[model samples]
Target: MEKYSTNAINADAPVMLATERLLLRQWQRRDLGPFADMNADPEVMRHFPAPLDTQQSNDLAARLCQLIARDGWGFWAVETRSHAEFIGFVGLRETKPDMPFGSCIEIGWRLAQAHWGKGYATEAARRALSFGFEVLALEEIVSFTALPNLRSQAVMQKLGMHRAPDDFDHPAVPQGHALRRHCLYRLARGAWQEQQP
Candidate 1:
């Protein structure tokens, strides 16, 4: 028997998620400056090819907003509840269709280096996953990262996603790049349910 029904993708929800210390919401103009700075941080962009310039970071943030405006949900802007500061993004992105696993939606995050050890990624991600598996009623949500990105991989494991056996080369990464090879992790709705209290 199929473990989960196919009724996924709720038209609403995921617009905004508020956790104990964070809020995930649509992008705002105030977020751009800090976002650009964060993207420019070499340590923050360590797994990627290089840090983003201001123009590139702004363009990327704009694109994320456009996606949210169209789909009602995406890698929403993350901020702190106490200070109400723009941190970074944490949510989902739909991968390309031709990949080995086919087109899949993945949960991901990026925050300022200052916020690294506070469990912000994990906390915000839990809300995102709740939005994905519960609000959207998705069958599965996957997360992937460069082979050396142990920090992101750690978040995925904390979310209870299992590491899949078949690792794949990322199409976006240039050939022979150290980060081209990626690790995949997945979480099924049925499995997420088992994790519930």
Candidate 2:
């Protein structure tokens, strides 16, 4: 396994990964407001159970920052290079214990509703996958979403991840909730390397 420096990630520093149009960097104080707004938007949170309030959003951002600081990589705060606008986050995170895929890395993204339909999510995710396979030396990365969230599933397909036979109920969601059932997707490092030029 590849190891990253345990030194706390500095949010103010420039990111190590940069796509042509985006920069996946550490979280900054400025990101909280926009992240909170994004989390509170019903349209944006439609796949999840409910929209987050300001406090809940801030707490989530704080937890993400803490994870990055501890692990030296995580769901990085993503921004457009041209405008430096905080669109959302897209990167790799360790799957929570409650998830069926234990002790595995997963790629995920959440962007402001206004930023949807642009190629931003796909572009940023491609870069994140490279970091996972090349930099982190992970054997595989997985992604899952509420079965109804075809938009995210489309992005997963664009990244060349295949649908896995195992569909799981998200433990974080209520058992009978409509969003509890999630479609799982997986991409092996060899498969990812094959797609690269």
TM-scores of all predicted structures? 0.93, 0.92
Candidate 1 lDDT over 1-197, as tens digits, reads 43223354343543788999999999999999999999999999999988999999999999999888767788999999999999899998787886778887899999999999999999999998888877667799999999999999999999999999999998888999999999999999899999989
Model 1 pairs in collision:
none
Query: How accurate locally is residue 7 in candidate 1, as Cα lDDT from 0 to 100?
Result: 53
TM-score of 1: 0.93
Q: In candidate 2, what are the lDDT values of residues 92-194, reduced to their tens digit?
A: 8888777887768899999999999999999999998988877777789999999999999999999999999989899999989999999999999999999
What's the residue-level lDDT of 102 in candidate 1?
81
lDDT of each: 0.89, 0.89
User: Against the correct fold, how does model 2 do in TM-score?
Assistant: 0.92
